[model samples]
Target: RNNQRHSNNDARRPPKTFMPTNGASRTSRKELLDLIGNNPGGHLDESSRFKFETKLRAYANTPNVDPSDVLFAIGSSVYGTNISFPVQEQTNGSKPSDEEEKETNIIIDFDYMKAFMKDVFLSYGVKPVHAETCSEVLIEADRRGIDSHGFGRLKPIYCDRMDQGILWPDKPIDVIKQTDTTALVDGNLGLGLYIGPHCMQMAIDKAKKHGVGFVVVQNSTHYGIAGYYATMATDAGCIGLSGTNARPSIAPTFGVEPMLGTNPLCFGIPSDDDFPFVIDCATSVNQRGKIERYAREGKDTPRGAVIDSDGIERTDTEGILKDMVMGKCALTPLGGAGDAMAGYKGENISLIRIELFIAISLGRGLNCVRTKCISVHHFKSDDEMRSKKKKSSWDIVK
Candidate 1:
């Protein structure tokens, strides 16, 4: 039964996503508008779905198009499993076999995407300015083709979280400590999608004054795209750095049961061109979410992405997910296997990450609750340590 359900979905394929850019020529814009205007019957019923309805409505209102035309344009953008374009013909003295369309084209106005996101959040009762900032972070990810972190998250963030009371639109992100080069931000348990950027910008401001800045945050929810914050730092003429530790998905090498989060690391380097050089990656060989994505598509995963319940590598995406998340399996570290095969190096890096999470955990006041926390019980004040050194010198002379 499960296999049949999976096969049925695989026959349908995923929907085609649309994203527009800023520099499209007028002719291209007109052609796109006309294409959409000419085809309006294929959209998923907007009135029945929460997130998609909001998005379709927004896409419909983009500048210089009729409401009727918007519906047609959206309809034309629909894609399914059977949608394919021929590349060449067969050659029995005839042409070679045709090639399939290799990619999908999506045109989204960056500005319009932002405005629509902002409107959706506000209509849903999020505060005005917070809505705008959240929109900026989410849409920027779409512009970059990072769909997992883009509009795809709107439901969990705004809709589902609203249902769960996890999203606090009115709660403020408070800065508890500040110096020339550092600050501590408390999220008040607010959405990280909103607070992450706030804390990062504070870091950027401090960096401007001291040539480097750092901020530690606690009680924050998921920050949409790590690159958004990192790029903000780079835009200020400094290299931007961002990382966040989440619910654990990684297990220590040789040890079982998950204890480490995917703990993504992101860096944005300034470039001479229009776009910054951005690299955002999860520390594990693969993100747990990516495995879920493969499972949804009825595809097999590549080797080395995961281990099964019995500690054997497997290609079945769903099996990998069930094993990893349920504590029956754990992901491989950034490097494969043990110290002899760079396992020790991966372990060392995880240790460094532990220190980082420790620092964040400490600032958040959650470290004390850790069952097996790293001990930091012995410490000497600077003056006491200096006096001890002097006394030791006298003993040596004696």
Candidate 2:
């Protein structure tokens, strides 16, 4: 999912116009709302509608995306391979109508989907602006092919968190410290969709005045795809970089414990080409999100992508997912197994460590980053790592 404007598939060619129309019958816009969480507060206000239209235009015009190169179409899965859409299939005791085969095969309109998601959040009492931001960031993931982080997360990650009273939708973000080129922020357990953009914009503002900007945020939940935030900088004609940590899932080379997250690092650079250079990937051979995707697709995880507690490579998607959470299996770092592939250089510098450093400095633990973490400790060879079994974990500061 690099920031390359690759050609979209011919079968899923985007409609010439994106102004949401109520033409599709399989999943008409009106019927589409029926599946959006039964949200009692079920309508986008005029302000939200206007904002969504503007947001749509903004997304279509992002520097890292080319309208002509995007398949902003519909599909069954939110991150469908064919750029289709997602709608839950309805199944009661009624006979299956040709259309109601349980929203299975439903091709939802993009705008309709976003509006529906927005209303769902609004009903949950999220601020209108935050709701809009949440919808925009998520749809961006689906559009960019970062399916794992796309709109599919709206329910499981967000709705559930908010329902559980953990994800505060309207909490005030706190800026604990600031400097000419850097800042530390606390998300107050609020939506990352809003917090991420807000902090990144702060950085952009700083960069405009000082030629460089950096921001560290903690206490935020999934903020959608990091690439989208980087592109915000690219859109402003500046280089953008971003990273975030996930649930600990990777093992250090020579270690089987999942002490590290499948942290992803994202980079966006403005280019003369139609699309900017947006490179985003997790440090692990496969990230937890991709593994979740594999499970949803009913596919096996790739061999070497993960290892069991015994350190044997595994490919069972279900088993890997279960083991991952239980800390029984660990994702392989960017490099493959063992020092033969230099897996010890995990993601170039343990971004997790950098995140820890920042958050620790702030008196809390913030999670996010991408880099191979290595200590300055000189070692003769891989043999040294094996021989010094009691060696301390490599410090990422170096």
**Top-lDDT candidate index:** 2
Q: How would you encode candidate 2's per-residue C-alpha lDDT over 1-398 as one tens digit per residue? A: 11222335522644333233223422333333343235343222444334333433444343333222222321222212232123333476455586444222323446766776687678778899988988889878876667787666666678767767767788888888889877767777778778788888888888888888877665666777778788888888888877665666778787788777666667888999999998877778887778888876679998888988897999999988888778899888878778888887774455543445433333333332221110100000000011212222333232
lDDT of 1: 0.55
The C-alpha TM-scores of every prediction are: 0.63, 0.67
For model 1, residues 153-174, the per-residue Cα lDDT tens digits are 5654555565567656667877
Q: All models: lDDT?
A: 0.55, 0.61
